[model samples]
Target: MIKSGITDSRSFPAVSIHGDLVITGGGLSGVCCAITAARQGLKVVLVQDRPVLGGNASSEVRLWILGATSHMGNNNRWAREGGVVDEILVENTYRNPEGNPVIFDMVLLDKVVKETNITLLLNTAVYAVDKKDMATIQSLHAFCSQNQTTYTLTAPLFCDASGDGVVGFLSGAAFRMGAESQEEFGEKFAPSAVYGELLGHSLYFYSKDTGKPVVFTPPDFALKDITKIPRFKTFNAQESGCKLWWIEYGGRRDTVHDTEEIKWELWKVVYGVWDYIKNSGNFPEAATLTLEWVGAIPGKRESRRFEGDYMMTQQDIVEQRWHEDAVAFGGWSVDLHPADGVFSEKPGCNQWHSKGIYQIPYRSLYSKNIHNLFLGGRIISASHVAFASTRVMATAAYVSQAAGMAAALCIEKNILPADIFNQYHIPSLQQRLLKTGQYIPGLVLQDEQDLVGKAVISASSELLLTAFPGATQVTPLTLSVAQLLPLDKGTVPSFTFQADAQENTVLEVALRSSSKPGNYTPDITLATQHIPVHPGHNVLEIQFPVELETAAYVFITFMKNPLVALHVTEKRVTGILSVFNSVNKAVSNYGRQTPPEDIGMEAFEFWCPQRRPGGQNIAVQCDAGIHRFKAANISNGIDRPTHQPNAWVADWNDPQPQLILTWSQPQQIRYIDLFLDADYDHPMESVLMTHPENVMPFCVRNYRIKDAAGNILADKKDNYQTHNRIYFAALVTTDRLIIELEHPSATVPAAVFAVRCYGGEVGQQL
Candidate 1:
């Protein structure tokens, strides 16, 4: 480690280029392995040939990451690990609210490189593997395109995530290709025949945003192909938040062998399809879309794979069978395109059918013949029938993360890749998985210890299931009483009740409400019918048929639109930033071209230190020199901000701009994070440094801060760089705090930052 006093400014690598785990292929699987290993605090080197991450889904290629979330209509269930897959959800859910491809790729790259334990090599490809006996991969030789250099990596465990089982093939691992007869895997979708052909690949494109038109040019052919117009409607000229273009599936031919040709053909169809639409005057709104992504990537739907200890079959997926060491799940169906799908005689017969979530055994990920090697993504051991159920991005991510985590564990234990699975500690290792918010729905433990335990309903319809060390069932309890009152049951639930006749005319009962403050609700009601009934934790939601009298303290309950969008902008600040839109109840996240159609889960979130025992707020963050409180246009102020979370702003000036904060934590929070700038041009409220009533006296020197009582609280010089941040500590709870800032110059109008609260601090664990 560099000495703090050295003061030398230089970037350094985290691990040796050669280590105990050499993961080949930079696709989703390889990236997942890199992420999982890093999170486990293991040294991992992630190599990728592409300049940017995300393989086929990268902005450079332009494909939405369709994970298992859409498995109902297709064959795409992937069972493996959830660590990396969940990270995608977490990152996209918050960072790129619009699901921007540029941001998505950036996020993937950042997650891989930012891990202190990971060494990420971009624009590099593993050319060959040096083996120490056939059972182990000794070193991998890789060439970096940009640097014009070669690098070698040595790892005890190696994962092939090239999406085509490239590592296994290069290492001489046993592999298989081509479709098998239906009897081989007992699959309804699999023909009773074997075929040399493969499923087709799609070249996806989309518009920049809605409400904009860009004249599109068609193919170079003199005459247009008008005969095949309706055949493309289900996928073409459709618009919702944004429009998609040229969503064509081609390449019924050998995908890998014809990758380059497929990409070119896909593009030709792209312009040709648009031309047909423009000339025919079909899709009156045809010109309103732009070709944002021309699908430059060749996503091979079928390819080479290492034969694993267990070859996953259609039966396993159909039965949802979980192995003792099961790490992933799948649900996409067996969707085999006709061998000549590009010129099929029949429509839709090009797509075979199978449905329901399927289970993927962990053994399917590693090579049965190759000792140290593992595979992920479309390259894993799946008979064509089972591969159909695992090809989606989500399932791929799950499998990749599991392989990565297993690799890391193997590196640490100095064991072979198969050792982890064979050991009894698999459950504990899986426990490491569950703690990170990944779900193992059908995990069957070899240790006879079960993770399923008492399930409790979270304030919102969220579930807070507890993991019982070893238990069978943990049902959620629901409030199922027909009537309960001081006179009816034991005693009426005592509390001051307020009813708004104008808002919620019908009184309704609620299951539970979040204690996250600002989220409290008097009229929040969750319908009992819709909420799944967990055995033990169901909150009864009974609603009154008619409006309740003002005098009648409600018997039932209801969920009403918040008078205004209410959320804690910053959990660590001492002031408030309000957004009360007169037009709508919610605030649209600006900057994001794609706004969510629904509110609710898309609700805003903030981070701060956790509350301490004395009921005292944890910290206070504020802007110092020149910052003001301004509410741009927040719904004409129907109500004033109350129980307001505070905010801090950074000056537009100063060689170093910062929003200074100070707090005392006796403990920590689960996670600490901050909301990024959404770029709402007309922000409802600018962040401010309010003078609190019980303010602490503090002194400032240059940029350093000191408590009036003479204790060093917080400081800022030119040392810290800033974009926007709410610093916090995990497992650390703070007490009273003081916040200040420095608006260095006039060019910097009052720096605007908002929503600050005091709570335990945490970071993005996902």
Candidate 2:
């Protein structure tokens, strides 16, 4: 091609990031696939037509992010567990600040960029495919709307995460759309015979506050019927409620051809449905509720089900069978929109799942005839019957992650996508999935050494793995991501670790399983952590205090899904960010920092305040109330309850995750102490150490502590123990302090009831 004289500033028409794997479409499934592949150490390229990332659930659309968490016993999909789906849930919780959507979008979008490993190209539409044959999809051509440019992309493996299965169709890969006859896939949800009708797409919206109610008028044919949406003789005979009514007949009418027309129809349906909600008087406030959004992009429930090596039928889902090659899990129902085009063939078309969730086989994720091509999102190898449940965004995320990881593997190993199927690489894929924080019960990290790869960047110089700085005998420290540590509040505690050296290196750190005893896989879970150490460390931080019933095994494994995890993460730094003074555990360095220490430091101390001590500042009248630190009594170590007892300020407290006394000083503090003694004459004298053993103490200096309060003093730590106990002690200074605790934290629960000065003094906190 000769260079046209249309001199432009563009360096290149479209430059592919040249990832080992390439995924077209940056929607939920596509994002998952991209991230999964990147995490596995493969270069990944993801292109999306939309400006935003999420296809179904985005702030642009105001769609809710739903998961398997429900107390009402709503039936859930089994294969929906773990993987990208779980990661979203964990993020959604933090995003719903004010328990609302504004924050959710901020977090969700951030996560898409932060969590996954794929290079994302937004506002790029894939126009054509360059597939040589079923086994080899050479390249994809796309037109970028942003700068009005055309480009080509090539990869060893390809994933079609577009809800419509656009690439699958363009590539000449076998695919099916619409509903099948009941006999076709043996899906009870399917029509008795085939027809052009479909279950009509949705145009979901959201609203919270006041705004002018918008109005919409249906077209001449808007009266076309559906079970939920009926045509009335009143107007153009159009009544709205989930209006996919006329959406039947995409067989001869391609979904892409009908996209714009369907998009318009969806708008009418959305406004019409909301009109009913307002006029019906079901919700008076809804009248003022703003039309935050209508599903901007019409989400196709049924599109191309690519024929993989194995096809998962509704029977497999209903039977709750386990496939040796299962990569993702899901459970919603076998919902087939009436293929007859009758919107309301039956009052309700959904066939509720027998259980909340089901295991989805791995074979369905890849093309049977195509070698290096995998499919994620809703277009997997299931017939119309099982897809209704599988089509949801959460389930699709998990599947996409798997597909992305598998695609990455294919690119790296020069293997075809077919080889990444259930029997061949299912275990490896499962392990990889877990590395991205997707969890499956049966799958374990096969090899700790083999699990290391790209996500874990090696460190340049020697840095402590502890949160802050130097470590002392008494400091209780958590994760050590170089200079990053869990903050007291506000921003979520997450950071990316970079390998110090240029050459590839595996990240490694010393970790201990803190799960409690007698529980299923330990409940207190930590945020999904990635290490660029020599090996991947794949396992939840399951913590358990004494009196707690369960704990996960102290497993230290590697991730297998995203193969780049083989490099694992390393926690090493060149210089110290802060120093702690162990002598008096105080804010000596808060004003100025000059490294307040000699080679052998002593008495440099700081104190984190405890409640109402010296019988002043604060007081609790009741003996019944207990200390509830956020990490203390946790369901999964995050959400803590709020209290409003005017006299005493009560922050959300749980006994375990432990109260952080971050110390950012200029020197190392080795001798710090906590004063834990019951107020004998206090009003609630009876409440003396209901669980004294909760008061486990440790020493932390400059390189170890996470605070600038100097240093905290406690003889030793009691990690996880079972005992109804009370705490009563004082921090004492000694040249060389030693205790019989023998690092007791391992066997004892971590709890600290009250921190005051030695004797009856309440000055600085402990």
lDDT of all predictions? 0.46, 0.44
Per-residue CA lDDT of model 2 for 1-766, tens digit only, reads: 7776765565646565455777877766777677666656777778888887767555454444433321112212112244444445434442342334345446556766774455667788899988776568899888888888877888777888887888888887888776666667555545444434345544545544545664433345433332255432122212221222333322224565676776676665555555555555555555555554445666555656778877777777655567888776665444445532324334324334333245677788887776667888878887766776677676777778777767766665667777766337667777656444454434533334221111121111111122211221211111121111111222222222222222334334222222322111111334334444333332222211223122222222222222232122111111101111122111122211222232111121121112221101111011222222222121111111111000111121212223332212222222232211111111110110121222212211111112223343433332221111122343232222111112112212222221211222233221
Can you write out model 1's per-residue Cα lDDT over 1-766, one digit (the tens) per residue? 7756666585332233755566666666677777777777667777888898878667665555545433112212112223455445444434554556677787787777777877878898777778898766777877887877788788767878877665677789988777767666655556433333466665655545457767766648422563553456554465411123123344355566677777776666666765665666767766676655555675556667568878887667655565787776665444455554434444433222222345566788888877888887777887876776687666787877777777766766777666777776566666555444344554322212211111110110111111111212211111111111101111122222222222312223343312222221112332222222222222222222332221111112222332211111111111221111111101111211121332101122111111111111111111111122222111111111122211223322334433322333332323222221221111111001111211111111124322334354445443211112334343433332233344332312222222123333244433
Instruction: Tell me, by TM-score, which candidate is best.
Output: 1
lDDT of 2: 0.44
- The parts of candidate 1 lying over 4 Å away from their true place are 1-16, 71-82, 192-197, 208-230, 233-236, 239-251, 287-292, 345-358, 442-766
Instruction: State residue 520's C-alpha deviation in candidate 2, in Å.
Output: 14
Residue 262 local lDDT, model 2? 62
TM-score of each: 0.57, 0.54
Error of 2 at 330 (Å): 1.3
RMSD values for the candidates in order, in angstroms, are 16.7, 22.7
